[model samples]
Target: MRVGSRRAPSAPFPGLLSSAQFAALAAEYRRACGFEICACDSDGKLRRGGAERPSEGRSVSDLRKHAVSEALRWGEPSVLSDGIEGVLWAIPVCQNQKLLGGLVVTVTRLRRPSKAGALDQRVVSACRVLLELGTRYNLVNAPLLSERRETARREQEKAEALHLMKEGTFDTIRSIYLREEPALIAAIRRGERSAARHAINRVLTAIYMLGQSRIELLKSLALELVVTMTRTAVQAGGNPENILGLNYQSLSRLADISDQEDLAGWLCRMLESLIDAIESNSRLPGSSQLARAVKYVEEHLAEALPREEVARAAGLSPSHFSHLMKARMGCTFTQLLTRMRLERARSLLVHTDAELAHVAAACGFTDQSYFTRVFRKTHRLTPSEFRRAKRPIRNASAPKSQTSARLYKPGAAVRC
Candidate 1:
């Protein structure tokens, strides 16, 4: 763009491009060139442009370079008919020095340039100048070459950004999954339902974060992340049989992000790894013992206890429990605790006459106010309201209870 250039020009070039003008212009040019078929190739596809056709694609690319070199050097084309026979001549159809494809022309019949034909070469030379001005600088046409380069650059930028984001995000997910394996396993052993869910959810949240970014990441990378997350969830004491356990569908939702099969395969591998981890962690020493303790805490949800207290009762140190949790489940002990309390509170609020404060206490909240706050934050609602909405009225018919369906669905599910 120049100092006086506007984003768009006001007027149109009629004879140059409009059908009415183009027909007349073509006729005039034909008369000037002794009635020959004239063709144009703004994209360098010479064969596609001309009716008789010379060659196209890679062949056109080669011919174009030759044409540009010869025309710039010796000035003017050789022959128009047997275009291949000519000493190629092509001048750039440029606005400034930016090469916008090439301007090419040839005589209808293969006319050899004799020593006496210097005068006709001047006519061809003049035509090239007209083309340069009419097509490149006119108000009617798009800057095709500039547009092409711009579009290519934009696509390249998107791909590069997606690659970088995907790598960083998945690294975080893997770390979170591996770090809390032991705690998750221990919780599952102890039969602590909430504990297992906490680990599962952390992984699920990570997946959601990646999914939320969704700026068109490499589909393969996204798919792999989803698969890896799903497998990990299932491994960490999660039940794949329960959609709430593995949440494979949630992982699969990211498939549209990438078309690369390698990512998809990697996702598949990750899922398998999670399944393997879960099966093996369950057989560890004191797993059943831990499971009992976990179940006690789960059934008696009124105690808002920490992972360390829970681990101590199960005869394991918090560190050991944490390791077992992550190995068995794919998330941490603290995460499991938070999920359990929240889950219990959600149930009491929805299904019982327990007030918000009482519900919070039953779910392990020491203070009713704090329980309400956490409940609001987790469910995006006040405790009383969540209960009111979730509870089926005595007179109204409703679908199956959310508590039964959602609380124990397979795969991982998130509260927030």
Candidate 2:
């Protein structure tokens, strides 16, 4: 037989095998082997076959495409298995050392042993005849086949990129905010850095997904989250001025950040600082009872704080609670309450323009005069002088310091 003809095969076999030719070959194979057969070109497109037509509710096309891919990948005949559809023999069609397309033959798993052996022999014979026809038609050298393969590869890459981008959504942000925001606050309150970090990371990841890796947009979203966190920490008892101040300074730097990694690092640092402030204002861990009593006094400082009532709230008798407070905190209930009130008064004086009477009432001192006396004694400066000085208050427990000498004695009856 003449081989390597440059003239394209007529009609159904223009440059490659036609549908009629493929069908005839498939029918002949199936008649002899009782197996379904299909053919595809180098680009993994189904050309023709007994099983190539799309059936309702069946993925025959996808199976044929996969078979074509397998044949091309291995550059030879091979067996391919599908979970739901059983096995396929992917036979590559090559001529003059060049690939043209593939032949895919379906094998039923239920066939008996003797029948299967006979079918295998028929399949081998059909593949040999197909290869010979491919060489004679010069189908393997067709330029269209190479173009189709390149086009398929490009389409696959584009599909993968789209899939990645579609994975994120606005709903993810809402879910993460609901789940992680509270956890982040609780972790900060407990002073658990690792837990706080984990919560923040989850939030960041959610935000990252929402924006699909857009660096500028992610930074903007992160800054907004930081603002919300700062407010939450303040509401949880962190100093408003301190928390807000830190937030402002951090935001100044954060606004300039455009890199994703830099943005995450800056946000983490900001969160850690907010957590530190909250931890500082929080009651000491392991002193639950003392913390409760102290919290009660702090909250009720604007009213009368009988030691009995405070101790009861802490689940301890007045005397026992007082002893525990002194041992663990180095201050009696009355002294601690006084110290907390003084601290509040100082904060109001320095941070606000409230009148001395209002400040005294707010700090739990009933009489303005008594409030002045105690404030001056503890801080060594009158409220007006302290506010005007704009200086931080000295620690009341500092030994023999000017402020310590002037400290108000706890439990001494004041006009309040």
Candidate 3:
């Protein structure tokens, strides 16, 4: 994932519902029980909204409010709301005196009273299976959540430690590169090799702190990074890569990778694949204005926004803006804007059948032909071909001949 997802705000859906997991099981329970429809919710509000019995108009007064309302009565568990012809099962899912949600089943409706009574027994039996959802969703989740929390906490700590070690590695390399060791290092900065070394250090740091016990986390991958770094370094006339490669080799035992040059050559795809897999998911512990500005640019790349405008928004003079952006994102600001625009353009080509010209204009291109050339250069596909090839079936409409040409209104260029 390019972006990390935040931890869930609260214990997610109640265990019983979450735990009633398998599709086949839920299907079988309903199919065998002859359920025509069902619904579920929690906190009386039915928050976040949930499954309702197959499409139908249900007035608030007409539906099974009695059973759902029972959260105030039995404080949750299975409940049967009896009506003239059938019964609705309302099972409330709660935790810590909080009603998370529930399962409502209109599983069976029989014409005969005796049959209805018998099916009620069947519903009770299904509840036995479903009651597990509450338990599975609730009880089991606690330990798993704790385990995950601890694991993430440990992983984050390991990441931080590796980050510090990489800082040390860079400090050493940077000191050698600059050949000017400054005392009490305030900031460890290197210009070009930042990304590669960061990648190696990220894994190395992860491995150093995390892989101590296994000694084989990212085992094959580590060797590949070092070797790739070595070859790329050699090709670059032994500048950063060679110096960094030697520094890296001393960091760990790439035991299985030695004497495997042919295997290494077969790994061109793997080398690219590995880099693709490692996204720039670094952390920000402190506040940053330039970071904020870059973030704004990334979020809104569709408009033909200017660098001066963005720099102005960041409250930095254009002279100093690029340096600040490089410090944070490790890339020049223009490169960032181009990347963001290209990404958005790619998304449009792949996801929407918006006219090629319009897509071009939306991505802030000056003209359609220029967009096509740049698109081909970046993605190796012409605009129309990319649209036809990448678009989904429903969205595969014919291309629009008109370019959007939607110019910005006066003074609506930048947002602070």
Candidate 4:
């Protein structure tokens, strides 16, 4: 009788040994090399061996954790010895610059293996051979695995970046970014070129150090600085067209920057240009009370914003502050507040997946119902509809129309 063809059991890592195969390999190594063996993944989770209870006064679990952590931290083979645990060796297993996991071996203290000893050399060679085989297997049958490893590495890099930003090295930089805005604006308005230049230099230096000379990260931070400069220019009475054009130009050229120093110099020049324009503008000097009111409104956008409270904060009577606000901003205090809150709401809606009720409360609306009514009246669509429309599918062939245009146009007023 003819027999049908049979398929072999597939290994999770393909040509690499399966768990049972690895167990048999580990047993062989233990017998040949006279050492206890265990394995762990890149995240320090145990994978094989070390199943027996710990010897008296020795915790097997803690030893395994330490082994994995050491291997990952050093990114190389490391050996640790203790009176009770003998000699513990941690060997990192990596492929294509990606850390896969580690192999740990416990050697007897009686042998006392040194770095150049025959036993140590043999064990290291064996571990390297196993990792090499695993690397070849991954390359041949698991290209997707390489992509996943790269994504993990990138996430780790971002986490490190955030940690560094919070550390002492970058803390002063963050303070300048957040707290020196008013000072920078005032310097620009007063045409204090040296003071403005000093402020800009401090901020750019901080960004440079924070980005660690990485071109992509530096460009990301430079673009954020551009946004801040644009807003400050607008508040300083610079022509909107000039300020926004500079912003657009800077952003468009970010990808072309290769050197951190060049990027910093370019940004400083652009900021200075914006400040010059602001100083040269024919508009009368902005009222200090109006500036104070704007600052107060920005800081208190989430709270109840009564006109009397806002006027008091600006050091003006309610009626006079209301008149000046209309003359300066071309809108009433309530209208301006609503516009600011809705601007914040629009930003959150586009960038986050927050619930509508949460968005309402965050933008200072008393309730979701009121937020919905105002949002619909102003934008001609509900919040949900607006969000859905904004998230367009990538690479889809859709023709643009007036609907998209209206969604992005300025002067889309919110009636208070």
Best by lDDT: 4
Q: Write the per-residue lDDT of candidate 3 for residues 124-202, one digit (tens) a residue.
A: 5455455454455452233433454456545664566556655665433222222221210111111122233334333
Q: Highest TM-score: which candidate?
A: 2
TM-score (all chains, Cα) for each model: 0.28, 0.31, 0.26, 0.29
lDDT of 1 by residue, 1-416 (tens): 46876553211222333434434544554543334322234444442124333442235455555654443333333332233444333444443444344445443333455566343443454455444434543521235534554455445545544454566744555564565567655554544544654554444445445656444554433444455455545555545665334455545655443433444444444444454445445544755545644665665557546666777676455666777777765667657666777876765565567666666666766567666666677789887777778766522533337545565444333321
**What global local distance difference test value does model 1 have?**
0.50
Q: Which stretches of candidate 3 lie above 4 Å from their native place?
A: 1-287, 298-300, 392-416
Residue 227, candidate 2: Cα error in Å is 1.7
Over the stretch 192-225, how does candidate 4's per-residue lDDT look in tens digits? Answer: 5655665665576567667785888887887777
What are the lDDT scores of the predictions, listed in order? 0.50, 0.64, 0.48, 0.65
List ranges where model 1 is wrong by over 4 Å.
1-290, 393-416
lDDT of 4 at 52: 38
Per-residue CA lDDT of candidate 2, range 1-416, in tens?
A: 78886864333334456656766666666554456666666655666544444434546556656666654554334455455445566655655446556776764453334654354333444444444444454544334445555555545544543454466433644455665677676666555566677677667766776676788878778877887788778866688878888987887897688788898899889988887787567654437777676667755788767787787666454666777777787766667778878877876775566899999988887468778888888889888998888744333334434343343333332221
Distance from true location, Cα of 112 in model 1, Å: 99
Q: TM-score of predicted model 2?
A: 0.31
lDDT of 4 at 135: 46
